[model samples]
Target: MSSIIPGTQNALTAWQPFNGARLSVTSKTSGVSSSLPNSLQVQIPKVVSGPIGFENTGYWGIKVQSGWTYQGSFYAKSTSFSESVVVSLKSTRGTVFASKAVMGISTSWTKFTFEFQPSASADTDENVFNVAVDGKAAAGQTIFFSMFSLFPPTFRGRENGMRIDLAEALAATQPSIWRFGISVATRWKWNETIGRLEDRPGRPNTDGLGLLEYLNWVEDLGAEPILGVWDGISTANYSDLSTWTVVPEADLQPYVDDVLNELEFIVGDAKTTEGGKLRASLGRTEPYALKYIEIGNEDQFQPESYAAYRWNAFVTAIGAKYPDFEFIATTLPSTALTPAYQRIDFHMYNSPSWFTANAFMFDDYPRNGTKWFIGEYAVTSTNDTNTLGDIPSGRLPYPTLQGSAAEAAFMTGMERNSDVVFASAYAPSFQHIRNYQWTPDIMTYDASRVVKSTSYYVQQLFSTNRGTHVLDTTPVSSNDTAPLFWVASYNNETDVVFLKVSNTGSQDLVANIFLGFTATDFATATAISTPALSPISGLFNVSNTLEEPELIIPVATSFALPFSDRFNYTFPATSVTVIALQSTTALEV
Candidate 1:
């Protein structure tokens, strides 16, 4: 498990031998690093007619595509063998996609690497990777395999890198921030992933997806990292109140020092700090950027300890060294703390209507002090109503077009108050189609496909069309209770006007963008909504799923018009629209 790549299925848990092969996968204590305590042992029977070995259907089935060269490595040894071993990838019907002949397997354990390209693409993800030996030659032999791995072309082609398709889908979002989703706990250790492939000392887990891999991933995506440091807070159970773990404030200095070490590894010079030296030894010479450091997540659950000392202990220690870096608090903001905090991380999960109604949530927030980090926000089927038998009967498994439209309304408000709302994101970003949490994710993916939710497209629409200045605009309604919402901004460098508008109402509304100055008459408009032909009853029900991922997505169109300072665009019913007006002549808003 220690040597397995981020996207590769590991060890011998998923491998099964071919029929008539006499080999059972299990642990052996004689080989490899101390971190990896187990090795797979295979036993071969005498008088076998065919090859004897193991087959791996990677994470269900390997998606064997043409023109992809898979890099695979393994450590193997046999008590007796007379011929070179064979490793191949093939379909269920014996369609050999790729094969490699590895030689020189002796009594001692030796590592080997192979690069093989499939002859053609497999129609479906029903392919398997096999490791076999000539049954006639080594009929009565015992073999041991450990730390085996196979990886397709990765993001930036880095070894042990992220999968190509999944990374591409996320990269398409044009994200500005990335977090590894590792938070506070003893299990959320970062040091377990750095030193070496097989000796990182991951207790019961792999060190593959560790600090370096995540940093590389963030760098590849062209995003900044939101480093979440453990703040000595953990709970054994959410419903039980007696099992929480809160390290005393006096005993938090060691953990605080560990955080400083982690920060130094990411931002210190190679010649200056021990952590930086370790990073340099691992091939990262120049330090990575460090800006946002979240002290803890949801510390509001333990407000007493957090407000009393937990927050101050870490902040004081970390701030003494890195004063410029912003510290985000997991609890509510207050002007009372001695060592001031910069931002408060907020999370919200509610029904679609609740989000739509609170679209102007930040309109009344004071902009004089601490800003906000919308750590998580999403629309769910259930509400805050404490009704009896409150189990959600028909929870929304995915983001619906309706819920996303409402969310876009809320996003417009957030953008209008960008000065106060520092950074925002749709939480629970991605999940496996088969295995996931309770909340609906922005992305649902399998081995072969990725479904970007309507909310994801909404976020992409906003992120990709961001502006430099938040221009003031008059309300579209005569009264303040209108269902339409919008925020206008101007990009100084690009000379473009970006208007993100959402029509939560059923009726289409034509709102004029009074651009205060002259600009191009034509603009590009993109929107995600239910088709015009769809019944109004099903407008909010339209969603992307595993069976139909593209059910509703942003469609772009550009057209010419005769206008200078202003333009009128119709906001579609229950939809989100992002309009970009690029100017030929200079236009100051």
Candidate 2:
């Protein structure tokens, strides 16, 4: 009795796992022999540099069922080099269900796979497979692998294997729209006595991925979800009891009252209609209406009178019981005594040309009216792993938990200054490439699977295309070129016109937009990508396993209704386009 498949084309035809597979192996190792298909040849490695050789441990199966979808591919070649390469799908008791990894330099044979859907604990048939090669493989480089088969679980534009309209049009972009939240106040904890996987649990203490599965994976990519909460600082150190610098402020108010009673059981577990229980209820006279709340993250290096007397007794007890909710204040080294602290969250690991050459560190911060939140930014020099395996507490050269592209153009100059910024999150969002400490994170999903980041499509094109009225134009070029544009003019009375464009320079940005008059046609034009001009070759390999997590997915392509009232449109450079124009005329260019 599993029904409920209404339209939108049956939710765009479910069933995914590399829709339409490909991967054949045995590229040539000259008379190679070990067994089954000559044990898949071997000898072309270098994925992060040195020590990684499955060389010939062959049998890389994939035929999945119980609702079908199995996509695995292979091709390898080398000349110059960089290092790192992995592929998996084991479960004949060998564990590992899905995996991915392929970093730096390639002389040819490029194509890797990891897409799944045999869930319910998979294994309907062909499954158990293995392939390893963790960096450095010269001595006559030559390797190849392949396997592909994406079929009906439902089938439409591609599910599980990805392309759900290009992951809702590249999530829609702004660093995947803020998703940094390390609950139980990350001083880092999760040993639950040999239970690994970040000590396995929920809300803060490191399961690392699960804040409602990161808001159902950023609301399944339509965008807008800047949420983070964890005022549970406990820095350890009962006299070097594994040193983290000891932050026992009288045991942090029962772990910030069990994180404010699990944020009041997730905003009073909203759900009601006769049977009751869904979760997210406000209006109970507003005790937890919260649009976003954060207050004890890096708690000023702890122990300062127990982190400023438990953040001034938790803003005098939840700001005298929810003052409409906005609260954010942690990671402050100097915001000048937190000015009665209402809003001020900063943590930039520097670089985007030092945030566009220190763009006034957020406009020469003065804070007369408060309001400023960056909440742990990243470019990575190493703060801890976010993605990229071998993390049994090793591996750190540049890991503010995985971030680069100049920290996604410093999150597009922090969304071109979202009007003095009020919310921004992107730290320790995810890390499970061998149990992280921080590497590269903007999105990482396991315990079910999920991944998105190029700064997560530039924060989902900036919170799903915002602009409810605020346009002053003026951008022919501020010394920028190649599709590097940024414009906003959202008027949602229903006439509809959400033109958010961000190219971030590289190429392909041929505009024409003159939304002054007569511009109807563009009912939708979503394009959240990964394989357009190679941004580290379409992501999704911070070593992802678990029955093939679509490596790094988010592809959405739709174009039909009217978009040529003399408005060419090309934009792709660094990608991020959300144009949903539906005008009937109403001024404001």
Instruction: Give the top-scoring candidate (TM-score).
Output: 1
TM-score of each: 0.92, 0.27
Off by over 4 Å in 1: 1-12, 20-28, 184-186, 201-206, 335-338, 382-394, 476-481, 534-538, 583-589
Candidate 1 residues 1-589, lDDT tens each? 5333322344345678875565444444465677765577777787786777888877777888899999999888776774788899998778899999898877777898998899999998888888888888877777777777799999889878988878888898899988553453454667777876777655433367788898999999999889888888885555554577988878988888888888888888898888889899999999998788888887777778888887888888888998888888988876555487778998777777777778887888877777988888887763445211222445678888878888888898889889999888787777877666554789888878889899999998999998999987765421274578788888888888888888887778887667666667678999887777755444566789989888887999996767767768888788899988887766555
Writing each residue's lDDT as its tens digit, candidate 2 over 1-589 gives 0111222232112112121121223324321111112113344332335434342121233333344455645444455444666655545445555556766536644545455544445543334444555343443354443222232232133232232433443444434344444544243321221111222332223333333433445545534554454554555532342454433557667656554554554454345321112233212222223366666555555536434566666555655654655666665544334226557677765433454334334534554676777776655433233322223233332221123333544454454555667667665655544355565565554322345555555465556656566454455322253235444465656555665554544455587666554556555655543355555543422322334344334455556545445466776544556677666766553
Question: Residue 84, candidate 2: how far off, in angstroms?
Answer: 26
- TM-score for candidate 2, please give it: 0.27
Candidate 2 lDDT (Cα, whole model)?
A: 0.46
Pairs of residues at least 3 apart in sequence or in different chains that clash in candidate 1: none
Task: Look at candidate 1 and tell me the lDDT of residue 1.
Answer: 50
